[model samples]
Target: MGNANQRTQLSEHIADILGTRDQPACGTSRLAIRKTIACGSMMMLALNPAQVGAVGLGEVELKSRLGQPLDATVPLTLREGESLPKNCVKPAPQNNSLARLSDLRVTAPARIGPGTYSVRISTTNPLHEPMYELSLMVKCPGATLLVRQYVLMLDLPGMPVE
Candidate 1:
């Protein structure tokens, strides 16, 4: 015999992040087993040569995105030098911000399951070609989903790696 219809207090998102460290890159952080990975992404960040900004999937900004009933968007404490990507508004002065890394999205369709994903990013300007890494957003089976942000750097021709 088994309990067929029982709602349990299975898992929560915030608690998971607090307890979690050294997490592999995953858009959706992991949740306890037997819980549904709550749909909808969390804050989307743009990684480029100069700065990392929160990208909006909808009309509202990523950090400001409203949370769902189950999977709440994690409270993001922004560090210094963080701002919205340049294209969100007029191009600022050269020293003000990083050039826009436009059209940032997953390079390939992700197969539904727990694993790493590949995100592809391209720059709006041609001269400032930058380097990037493949970051992952992992999720536990049957767990809520959220987006994890990353930072990338570029090496210009004459720049020293110091």
Candidate 2:
């Protein structure tokens, strides 16, 4: 019973963060909530299709590497039809769908070493919108690391919609 209450509270908190506290759970907010819960420790931010091309989304950054910390702006441009870089491959399936959602890949900077990293962006206001939360996952021999960051999606001209 306590666990159930916690889940309810969490859902409510997420709804509030999403600015949908007053709406029924059957709407888009519901889908967002379900997606959040499904991701398990993953959170999402939802942008209206019309708002996709707006200015001021902010620059997203990856602030960690392997377990070390560093600041790097993540490039949000979608990479199409390219294979994963050597030493970085699809992560094993987990109960959470984070792996599946991490379809965006970008080349890692020298500071992060060789190999590309997989990134997943979700709508979240754990801080604020436009300024969002991002998850960076690095998979390598014998170890996997996940890092979270609150960043602004870059305001780029003609940015593609995810």
Candidate 1: C-alpha lDDT:
0.29
> Using Cα atoms with residue i matched to residue i, what is each candidate's TM-score against the true structure?
0.23, 0.23
Give the candidate number with the greatest lDDT.
Answer: 2
lDDT of all the models against the reference?
A: 0.29, 0.39
Give stretches of model 1 more than 4 Å off: 1-99, 109-117, 123-142, 158-162
What tens-digit string does per-residue lDDT give for candidate 1 at 1-162?
133323222233444544443444552344422123322222222223333333222111121111111111212222344432222212112222443334333233222222211223333323343523222232222222324443334444455545
